[model samples]
Target: MDLDLKCKTPILSYSDDEFKQILEIRGKTLEQLPEDVNIIKEWLKMQPHLPMHPTDRQIVCFLIMNKFSIERTKEKIDANYTIKGLMPELFSKSPLHPDVQKTISLVSCGFMPKLNKKLNRVYVCRLESTDVVLLDGYNYFCSFLEMKTICDFSDSDEYIFDFSYFPMKMVTKFNPMDFKRVLTLVEKVYSNRIAGLHYVNIPSYAEAMINLIISFLKPKIRERVRIHKSLETLGEFFEKDQIPKEFGGTGISLSEICDNMNVLSKEYDEYIKESNNARVDESLRPTKLINDDFLGYHGNFKKLQVD
Candidate 1:
């Protein structure tokens, strides 16, 4: 597998020193990987009839997530396509309907425009309203995948979940299956991208909500989850200027960030549309579907203790 380093846009920007640090962690150099373009070419050679050629940045994301292990990267690439094919509702096409957009907007999630000194991007989410009925899990998941496309530049990501205004009623509305599906994709397909997850102003009763979500993560990732009693505590992990004003930081407000993401999401519309066609043909695949396949899991939501 050849690496294609030529990205049309800066997916993740790193200084020369930071780039070296990343390579050292992976035990490889840019020269060894070259450009990730070759990696996509090799994948095409193997599959021969994939619906679309993944962008170089997307290929780099798989490579970085897999620690530059060619074999592991190949497996993730295949699984990525396979999952997208299986879960078109979440992976293919952006949701542009007015109602769908309104539902997603109500979720109050957006990526911060700034990166930390380490260059890890920050994702901020909050529930500004108590109308849980207004939130659509499928649309939320789709928006997440859309946001994930722009997060490819950095190998690590930091998440801040602000639950200051979280409604207790919203807890029961949580869809465990949708939650599990998102984690499944993150763990199986977008592995090793999350560096840290911080929960701020968490209500005491919301511990159950956190526990339910954490149960889906691996041990290492579970360990990365932190609950903070105050914004000051979160400030220890990130600079004040790096944080958004909505969170008591000096940066722009969450509303502004969401507005910017709205524009950026539109730009990804075509890519998402094309992604719908990138499904895997099961008959042509060398492996048979198993219970552990992307969409194989099925059970009662009651089993997840959502009630």
Candidate 2:
């Protein structure tokens, strides 16, 4: 299936009625898109700390991801820039930096071209080689998330993490502290309200590590995590055809999906370059800001200044 990459809007597969129903469920409508976007634009003008002016489409996406809560949308936008401004190790790099490109070769990860019944985007990630580096993998994910946050339109996302070839010795490959940082950035910065976190083909040795990761999730989200022993079980939530062919579904192969992702990254390269500079100026922040909790640092915003 072709990912409608030519358009500046979401990859259009949903019929108008279905799309409207999804919007209505979130207390939003196509009619309110422009008005709500304008409201956010006006709000941005008042925040001296934030420098970026996002597109109308990005604003609408933030609104949907936040369930149409304008207040939450504003907070998400602020955190999006604030965290990026503070963490150069992850966010400040170019989307297609060498490490990120190397990660594409090391792992197979991509978003499904179509939305699930709940209209949440589906993502599948698999390790291809035991030569996995957590930092590189995260950089790849960050690049992908950044591009999606700006370019794709989706309210929420569900992830299928395939640990098929993952080595048992590296169960501790990703530190718990690093995991927390990544979790906060995705949930707070991009407003990625996760619908489900499904794990398939988990090795016996990795149970403790998986549990540690789950411990970091909010209770509601933790309840949504499922450890699958059988691929058929996933059918309870995802459509049979949409599941990647690697797992017995008739849908697009994960490799092909990654190819689409590569195309997507290229298409948005210029946009990422321009927006990476869009960050919060801590000096101008109107309220008291303490980042003692972000990425495990204890200090005022000025102490952790990245830009």
Candidate 3:
């Protein structure tokens, strides 16, 4: 089997028919939720129907976009780049379900809460560490054997319960591995939302995408090529013996590794260049220090001081 990069292009090309299918599946799940369920009933009564709400579709598409070809996504981002930098402000507090309001308050003052074009309510949060965006249209109201339970703002058991009633067709095409990843992402997002952090910065989105591709291409390769590719990077943490001064790995240094893996490194570089429509050069690679400003620190929260 040709282990090709799955991200040759962004998967933002879903057809209108496919979008309709997505909505139908989403709406089906939304409607099947118990009518007596506090927030569910309220949400359903207020919103129009599936496919009508673009935010939900955008969330789903964003996840799908993560799986798209890096080159393709880069082209799209470059063409309409400004929009990408400004993280979509979907996570808001005011119009939220009381339960959601309380949950998010546990972590943050919350940002950007907008109405879906169809005017449905959905909460969006970005995880800076992971470059992951989370969407929550279903508010957090739980039911026990006999009673209903509203999640407290401080409760941190953030998780994405299976919307089991959703039509199976909606997920039949998704890989099992992807399903697990999506679920984990959703739960993490919920946790962050409640905690009020924008996101957790692991590898930046670019590095993560590159690393994901490397992992996809060579499932067994363990090296972190997803990071900078050079001697300078490796030397910072390692010593002449090629052992990490801090740890024990030989500080042989990344400069040495660059020599050893020049070809593979070039491949990664070329891929990035092609994505951004830039000439293939070391300068174009995404090896700069991670920018902290966009890492989701909403800055100091000081209400105006009235003299």
Highest TM-score against the true fold, candidate: 2
* Model 2 worst lDDT run, 10 consecutive residues: 1-10
Better of 1 and 3 by TM-score: 1
Compared with the true structure, all predictions reach lDDT values of: 0.66, 0.73, 0.25
lDDT of 3 by residue, 205-246 (tens): 243333443343223233312233333343342233422222
**Residue pairs in clash, model 2:** none
Query: What is the clash count for each candidate, in the order shown?
Result: 9, 0, 20
Write model 1 residue lDDT over 205-288, tens digit each, in one string.
Answer: 888888888887779888989989987788888888668897889867888777766765676656655665576665565554
Error of 3 at 244 (Å): 51
On lDDT, the candidate that comes out on top is 2
* Candidate 1: stretches off by over 4 Å: 1-20, 35-40, 132-151, 286-307
- Model 2 lDDT per residue over 23-63, tens place: 78887767677777778889898888887766666777778
Task: In model 2, state the lDDT of residue 58.
Answer: 70
